[model samples]
Target: MNRKTLVLPAAAVLLAPLLAACGGAEDGRAIVVGTTDQFIANEDAPAPLDPAFAYDTGTWNILRQTVQTLLHVPRGGGEPVPEAAQSCGFSDKASESYRCKLRSGLTFADGTPVTAEDVKYSIERVLKIKSDNGTAALLAGVDTVEAKGTDEVVFHLKSPDATFPYKLSTPVAGILSKDKYPADKLRDGFDVDGSGPYTMKVEREGEKAARFVFTRNPNYKGDIAPRNEKVELRAFADAGAMGKALESDDIDMMARSLSQKQIRELTETPKERIRVTEVPGLEIRYLGFNTKAPSVKEKAVRQAMAAVVDRGALVNGVYGPTAEPLYSLIPSSITGHATPFYDAYGDSDTARAAKILKDAGVSTPVKVTLNYTTDHYGAETAQEFEALKKQLVASGLFDATTRGAEWSTFRPAQKRGDYAVYGLGWFPDYPDPDNYIAPFLDSDNFLNTPYVNKVVRDQLIPRSRRQADRTAASPVYAQIQKIVAEDVPVLPLWQGKQYVAARDDLTGVEYALNTSSDLLLWELGRGTA
Candidate 1:
């Protein structure tokens, strides 16, 4: 996932512009939602809303509501259930082949018939384009996606993967109209031609999405029944403006972009009209090292940095009670969670960091630049990076500097190895331990870092995936986390707590988010408090 920038809390004047952007509220028929997620478009990522190139949480939030995948993770959360497909499962005991039969009478937003060919084409286009930041790597196990007849789609995997079904549930596998989307290129413009529960009309400001108006899809053929007839998602400059809109009754609900201070204030001083719901989230923030960079190329340099960093202080000072220090790639709630980082570092000792540099014969006052986005994560991200710099500088072994850039430029620069280290936040594509670790460690990792481990990437991950029972893969995952701690390619910082604040009259705020934290706008509607 990409991180946004931090700005000082907004003044009351910031509220006026956001309120004007609401375009006059509906007569209690449409639910106006507020967020600070700005989707950036550039040459590398010309279409931020297209599934083929879209990977960030903000883009995925819009895609999930408008696009239909073959299967979907239920609101309450559990095993995958068919959405576009009438039925789907592994066809063989090896889990190398899977089949799905499409539901009849399905139609895209443009009213084109949905077919198995669309599924095959959609999956193939993602692999064909293979955009650098796209999710093609997630489907790397697939050898071929075949359309057998008009209703049946088959996936032939190169290896056994029990998580194949779960992968299909994500927007990466969202079905698209073959006629609308080019086979070798990403579809441009803000228009969506999906067969999901809701059809969207986007209002754009330059390259970013300003507002999205979603109406129930009359052509939809799925299990979801949208509780609200219409819903409008409005983007803000920062969380402070979003909070103000929520307070002034300009929007019915606020999505997951609230600042740490905003969450505390809302929780501590409960508003009569507003209600806050806190859920355990899979969101995690970490610092990724560019292993090829001169400042941190040596293993000793990375290890020493990790040893000196304090995650506890990061939580207490920056994130407050809204987050907890995370020591492993997988959060504690996951099945194979381990504390390898804690095991190696043992709670930030300056002496240990010094010994690491001394033992390796590295020079003191190591110089490195830390880069973070200026507009994506939250208002406190800058504070978080500054705190990190202070900790590193205080170690007496390193000189650290922090840099900020808007996400549009920051993401591509990180891919080009512009900084020694950069910050990133991950919202899982699916709620699995593999989703947490694979994207960072796999050969085609999301981070363009040069670090690669053959054992973790080629051996352990495959071994773990072959097991149908997730619990059976626990030991293998534990070994993977241990290798991460030893290598220090990425440093786990903290796991976030999800807070969704909405008008008390809203009925489904508690159920609007899936396990991976994707907002399900269909679940929201007006009701008695």
Candidate 2:
């Protein structure tokens, strides 16, 4: 789930034009990172930087790593290990209620001591205001969260949940400094005084505005495998530009999606100078069909689209080996990864797709609109969709029209089923395959599919969520994927291969699906090793 590379000192003298001209070395020490999407300023950054908001990956990486949680993922995969809480377990035998006791001497960035009340407020406040959309869904079964004492917090679950603490460990549930943030809405004020190991110096609205800056938390107390003073994140227009910035040494690292061509260049670069580590990315990319359309609403029409969708061609031509052909809704690394979809639908066959469409009496090509985030993923996304359009039209199956919007408007619009089809990528808020299947596939889910899948809704998702342990949940997840094939809510595209290009001097950084998805910024820069 995590990997480490030799860390280069972020403070290392980077190659500078004038300094190099004089044969003088430059301290290329600042660990500048590059990306295509523009980042909003940190001051204007939305709410608690607390995990409860768990909305965007960019905010999570900045806020999550700086804080300690009651639970966290240890080196290898298993249940979360106690970090802030010295000892924690079920408060009752049924495992419905849970409690945790904090480690002594922990304090916030403001030097005010950390307490169980802070954790209670962090969870309870979000429950009370519910300003943000997804927080309530994440805290679904929670009946109450109470501060039992100065050091202990008790959670009362509406249903028995073995994975409740794991859910709490996600960024959305990140603890805040109860002393600083108001119990109500922070979405407008951008007040993020938390107990994280690092604090934001500046976070702009997006890269086009200015650079995002961070400073080490002076009053922080916690354990980090590798420690560093500060971090800065800068965004660019597309992966092509981000790659160029890295090659030119304008930035020290990058964690955003890269084009297949960019990956080839990053990996093929001499191993001596640049560091490229390919990890199993927890990100899921979807080619979503707007089933709200009368033409696409029919099962046969949806199936035809899936039948003609060439995932292999999409990856090979559009993304290459940097990504793999994904058939199931969940990734193989997940416990509930299912092959049911693949078993039912199989690979693309244009002839079969044509027949399916024809038999359904869809003789006329369906003119559909495809939408995508203009800035989030990368430049190649539009091209990839264009390639898919060519393939679909070459077979005389369907006609496609493409459109774009920035992620802010685009996400809400697609979720509202405003477009005929769209490209969206998901970074799991939590690592469970349930996170994959539960959120996206459920017809009522926020990323709601317009197609109503009775089997998936009534049985599969609920059954998987009810399974006491995750490993026991696979059969239901497999069933969900199979139902997905029959209903064709969205086309499963390619599973991404994550690439992080950081200066060679940075080390001990790894990305996890649930928590921060950070490069473990604490493990970055200015190390003696």
Candidate 3:
């Protein structure tokens, strides 16, 4: 599962926005998409569409259409190409200084011309707000941004970071109008202003966006063209309902949130009118340890838990074939991925786990409370945790208890270190090894754990970042993964595979997902075949 979204019956809500798009659907110029992705649209911190705070893939899917970035990953995943910018690259060989030339005649959704100052303001505002729920830490390397002129922008980095452009390709660096958004505060609304391929109008039901209606933006001037005139994204409570909507012809596509059973039915049975496409995904689920916590404070205790986990059994039993066992923070699909955990502790060995505890002078049946978010990670998550609890307890060397909360409360509590151990998922902000390793191990890490290794934080990551060629950084990343395995700051669980189920008549369903797993709705349209 990518993220959260509220569910509503497809036929029940005939809202005006949806009705308008429905009229165009008859002509094959309009398409309806269903997803289980969700976001919070409240006054306090985040409001879904705010570029600074819209960090999840669900929100990014909507933003990718309406909010334009300087660069963008191409259809079906590849190197990023210019979107709002005509050209962008590092100005120096060290990958420390980067520059971009914006495409001329660019205009925001509000009809205001987009200038370099707006780009500068957009990047700076994200850094200034620095919301914990946001991806501000991705811009940690940036020292300052300068608007050289109306069409040119330069970024001066605190250090060398070859992955910076990939970060820019994400919605984290989405260009917004300076006049439309405040410099120091998150824009507190579902409305958005950008120069992407579509103009979006959000229909709200309380704090949730019930539906997102996107009309083709006539003023959008970029590398890609919209294949359809309109797209309506319908929110489903669960994958079951979303699948039903696709089967009943209520929606043309179901993306990012399909359950394993739904995927199996779509792929195995071969629905004549429907088809499913599977792509390699960068999404991963893991367990984070509050290293200062009493129970897991000892390195041996954490290592014991890691050695006892049977990733193969957990993935196959709970997730079917939809997910694969993951040993490293970086997925095998990403370059520089190494299996240090497997190298250190191979498979489930209760004797090995017991010995680890005994060597550390720790007693048997060490009580540990495991926490997880109930609502966000799909229906199977509860089963996954239950399976995990059984595994730990079955080892006869530990006592494990499971606790869960809704995402709204769970995330804040995890950040506060309320739980000794918690499970969380990561979908890449961009498709790179740095996106996997840096976020957890960096100085101001997203995990907020007390575990710190100066060598990994200060030396290995920075050394890897300096290489312009990502492949050249492989050995450094290998060392970093080994350190993570040894320390057990966070235990890697499983890596996911992306799937999208759409009507067989859809033309561009195969190319709708980009390199970073962000949905590009502009690629979808009715097919002649």
TM-score of each: 0.94, 0.86, 0.93
TM-score of decoy 3: 0.93
Task: Kindly report which residue stretches of model 3 are placed more than 4 angstroms away from their true locations once superposed.
Answer: 1-29, 43-45
RMSD of each: 6.8, 6.0, 6.2
Better of 2 and 3 by TM-score: 3
- Sequence-dependent TM-score of model 1: 0.94
Candidates in order have lDDT scores of: 0.85, 0.66, 0.84
**Tens-digit lDDT track of model 3 for 1-529:** 1211122245523342233333234474569999887666654445667888776778888888898999988754667899899999989888889999999999987689999999999999999988776378888789999999799999999999988888898888999987888899877868887888898888888888889999999999899877779999988878888888998999999986889888777667877678787856788999999999999999998999999999999999999888999999999989999899899887788899999999999998999988998778787888999999999999998899999887767877888889899999998888889989888988666786788999999899999998878999999999999999999999999998788888877756656765466787877777543
Residue-level error in angstroms, candidate 3, position 166: 0.7
Query: What lDDT, from 0 to 1, does candidate 2 have?
Result: 0.66
For residue 10, what is the lDDT in candidate 3? Answer: 51
True-vs-predicted CA distance for residue 204, candidate 2, Å? 3.1
Of the pair 1 and 2, which is ahead by TM-score? 1
Deviation from truth (RMSD, Å), model 1: 6.8
| Winner by lDDT | 1
